[model samples]
Target chain A: MSRRTTLLTALGWLALAAALLGLAPALLSDFRLGLLAKYCCYAIAAVGIGLAWGRGGMLVLGQGLYFGLGGYAMAMHLKLTDAGPGQVPDFMVLYAGGEMPVWWEPFRSPVVTLLAILLLPVLVATVLGAAIFKRRVKGAYFAILSQALTAAFAILLIGQVKTTGGFNGLNNFQSFFGYSLYDPVNKRMLYFLAAGVLLASVALMAQLHRSRFGELLVATRDAEERVRFLGHDPANVKLVAYVLAAVLASVGGALFVPVVGIISPEDVGVGASIALVAGVALGGRASLFGPALGALLVGYAETSLSESFPGSWSYFQGGLFVVVVLLLPGGLAQALSALASVRHRVGGPPGGRRRRERPASDRTRPGPTTPQEVTA
Target chain B: MSVPGRDYLEVRGIRVEFDGFVAVDGVDLTLLQGQVHFLIGPNGAGKTTLVDALTGLVRATGLASYDNQNLLDRPSHAIVRLGIGRTFQTATVFEELTVLQNLDIAGGVHRRARSLLRRRRGVPERVHETLATIGLTEQADRPAGVLSHGQKQWLEIGMLLVQDARVMLLDEPVAGMSAEERRETGELLHRIGQERTIVVIEHDMDFVRDFADVVTVMSAGRVLAHGTVEEIRADPEVQRVYLGHTVEGVA
Candidate 1:
């Protein structure tokens, strides 16, 4: 990109972020602001999905596994805090016969909970990614493996009702770091916090998208054997992206608990995970803003649709996805490109010859969620 | 055949089996440094399979060593790290990347760091030099996928050159090219042969006659003849079973 284009893009992103960050507090009610905060957390995870699936082509279908890991860790810490000093969590006392599981003891410390939130998901993803990528597992097979992982994870959590709160999951937190949750002021603060984190995640990914390693990740996705022949391990390149995606999902999950005041198996199951990917696909997996904005829109639409139709909102969501897949294959990004081209036709000479002459073969392949070219 | 005191690539008793059939059976080969060796055979003659085994892309029991280090049983990527690079029978450049980016990535692989923040460009001097050698300097910014088939082949060769692999295993580098493209590729190989050992698997006998320093002809999973172009041509068994009318017309 030219220096002028790069500068314009940066400024555009900054202005957009500032507008988004200011809108909720200025216009929305406390409840609506909190709901937007929940969507922001989901958008954070969607950004990671864009990187891993859209750029790396890993199709991470089990991000819920990492999200749940971070959510549960944060919930455990909060539950312990609500129980007060040296007391077992109320749910544990009531459900686990008044004895806190020895495992939950360390989470009483904020430090350990935060560390586990950051490290546990990454650790799990690294071990899983290494084993899978090393064996050259990819495509739909990888998708199945990840979906199975999320299913099994949900089942395990459900079975541990006493410790995990089972089907009900964990909720009803009174405070976050001793700030009263009942205070509307503190509630809005959480929304800003989530917005700030989401913005930061976008910036981090933008940097990564420009880096050499980022380019290597895209190359590995397009041609694994050629990447191997180039003297760099494709598996390692993929593993790094997978681990980063897992970390992002984990961070999103951690933030989710305080903002939404709920962390349940339903929120981290196969359906939920697929919903996350659907948002990315709907938005344009290759575009930088597509995943996050798509996720927020999906969340908003789901809430609004469900309010109107109650039980049949899922059908509308499914129909929207189908429309995007069949007509706008590049998701909303393609629509944006089409609009820009139409504008150019109305105002300018027919653009560059290379852009005009790109073959249909190039268009047939799936575009990477990033700005890389379509593979042949 | 073993050549004493030579310490480059050595292969002995290499065998590749699939189910109950043998693809490459009990093949022994040796290579010296900086020699351009060509492996030629008819269709299904196990030439490509032997290259796969040599590069650790397939499982085989054999003493495959390069620079006294065992290349056998090692993964393909590890073999590349051991100063051995390869190109596929069909060109396998990352179609999404530009020509310069392709050569840059290949050249930068060795210098890559594990740090997330370490930003660097592709190896500039080497990539520019390789682009000139392959005559794709003008198309440096074009995506590899947009190039013609023959240019893609040259780009793959450029990739191997940029990687600086001591031993380059090019599989059918000129399989689908015009006569002029084939001649250009032959000249490119001849030039590259000055600094590296290249084991090319090709069916083009004319290209082999023009560029091969040593020729190994195989038929039905066995080495039928191994010698210079004239020596292999004179071997009756190779002529009768493998080359037949093909060599007479080409030579």
Candidate 2:
């Protein structure tokens, strides 16, 4: 991109970060801040959905599996930590006769829990994605397979009630890395941490969108056969995007556990996975900021609407999603673009020249990669 | 067309069958380096099927080799990585991506890693050169879906150019092009053929006659004739099977 455009984009990102980091804390109460933190975690997962479904064209309907992986991983460590050094977790004592499952033993160490949070989802996605994509599974079949996986994962977690806390899930956390959760100061800190992580995730996505891998993933999405003819294994391109999305979802889940103080099948099921996708779709799946912002908007709307109309808020949310999708298939981003184009039309001929002349300068000139040229 | 014993591509006994019906049955072909070869046939003559078999897009039992490496049974993308590039009968540019981005992806496909941290430096010199070559430099920033049918065709061909494949397999490159576009594409193929072996599957007899260095005529899943364009034109069997109803009549 031209230096001016790059500066503008950077400034825009900074403005967003400043608003989130500075304005939010100064304005909101502790309860509201905590809610925003939970929303931020969902937004992080939505960003991953945008990458996989929006750009890579992989309808990852089973992100909950990875999300649950990270959430459960972190939850186990916290539960063990709460139970103290040599004792079984309280849930195990209450439900499983004070016997910790062998699998849960590894999460006793904080370092191991963190690493698992980072690596376990990526590993699962790699194995599953490689197998499915290499065999050339795609379209609705792939979507169904992913959805089924999420359903099965939720079922397995529910069925293992003695060890998994049944449908009640893991909760009642008292500390995070030694900071007592009861302190409002620590709660605010956790909110900042969540915001910071969301910002970092956005920055990471921006970097990937400009990278060659991002371009290849988009290309694969558009035409897998053509990409294959270009000497790229489309499966590999898709697998990378899938695995990246899994890691992002996993990280989001890890953060979710501490922020919400709960990890349950309800939060990691086909319904949750589709809800995540709905947020991305509403935000404009292909856009960088759209998914995150869309998710946050959805979360806000859900909470406020439910507070006002407790029983019927879900119908309102569903109706709004349906209307946005039907009226503007490209989501909020498409609506914004359409508005801009309309303004351009009304504003006169000068705006027209820019679009027309873009190809000449962009094609013939040797210059830096333009952000719009890459991502758009 | 003999220099020494070096063959650019060799195919032996390729056969493709689906549910007890043979599409491409027992075909052997050879391609020479830096030449324009055309494979022409009627609608159901298995010409595209043969290309599919050669490119590993279809299940085929045979021995096929490019640069002394066996190609049979390899995956389609693996075959492409072995320096074979192809275009579909239908124009298949990435519709959402711009013309330049489409070419850029094709150019960057062979790069060692599609890294997250490392941005592609710039549009490669070759990509820009290809835009000019295909006469689409002016439309490079436009989304490929907005391009006209003929423009999309040129863009796909431009993609092949940027891919830098040793062998280019173009399936119906000029199938739906206007007369002027076809003429331009013929010229483009002539220029491109100077560097790489090109196997063009075309229905346009005039294009084949005007531009082909070698013509392989297929009829019902087998080679009816394989010779220079003139030799194929002169052959009675090719005339009866493929060119019999032509106005020009293979004169």
TM-score of 1: 0.94
Residues A137-161 of candidate 2: C-alpha lDDT, one tens digit per residue = 9877898999999999999999998
At residue A170, candidate 2 shows an lDDT of 93
* Residue pairs clashing, model 2: A1-A369, A1-A370
Q: What is candidate 1's lDDT per residue for B3-115, written digit by digit as tens?
A: 54334678898999988789998998887676789998777789888888888788988788776777887888888888898888788888877788778778765674754
Q: Which pairs clash inside model 1?
A: A285-A369, A286-A369, A286-A370
Q: Which ten residues in a row have the lowest lDDT in candidate 1 chain B?
A: B242-251
lDDT by residue (tens digit), candidate 2, B1-251? 24333348888898999899999889999888778999987777898888888788888998887877788878888888778888888898877678988888887755667343466677789999999999999998877877989899889888888887878888998987898888998999888888788999987778887889999988889988999988998888988875554433344
**Can you tell me which runs of candidate 1 are displaced by over 4 Å?**
A1-5, A350-376, B1-7, B115-123, B243-251
Per-residue lDDT of model 1, residues A1-376, tens digit only? 2368557658857975876687667898888899999999999999999899878988888999999999999999999999999998888777988887889999999999999999998889989999999988988889899999999999999999998999999999999989988899998899999999899998887778767787788888788887888877889999989999999999999999999998999999998898888888888876777888888989999999888899987788788877776676577877887787667656765566645654443453446533222211
Chain A TM-score by candidate, in order: 0.94, 0.92
The CA lDDT of each predicted structure is 0.84, 0.83
Q: Write out fnat for all predictions, comma-separated.
A: 0.55, 0.71
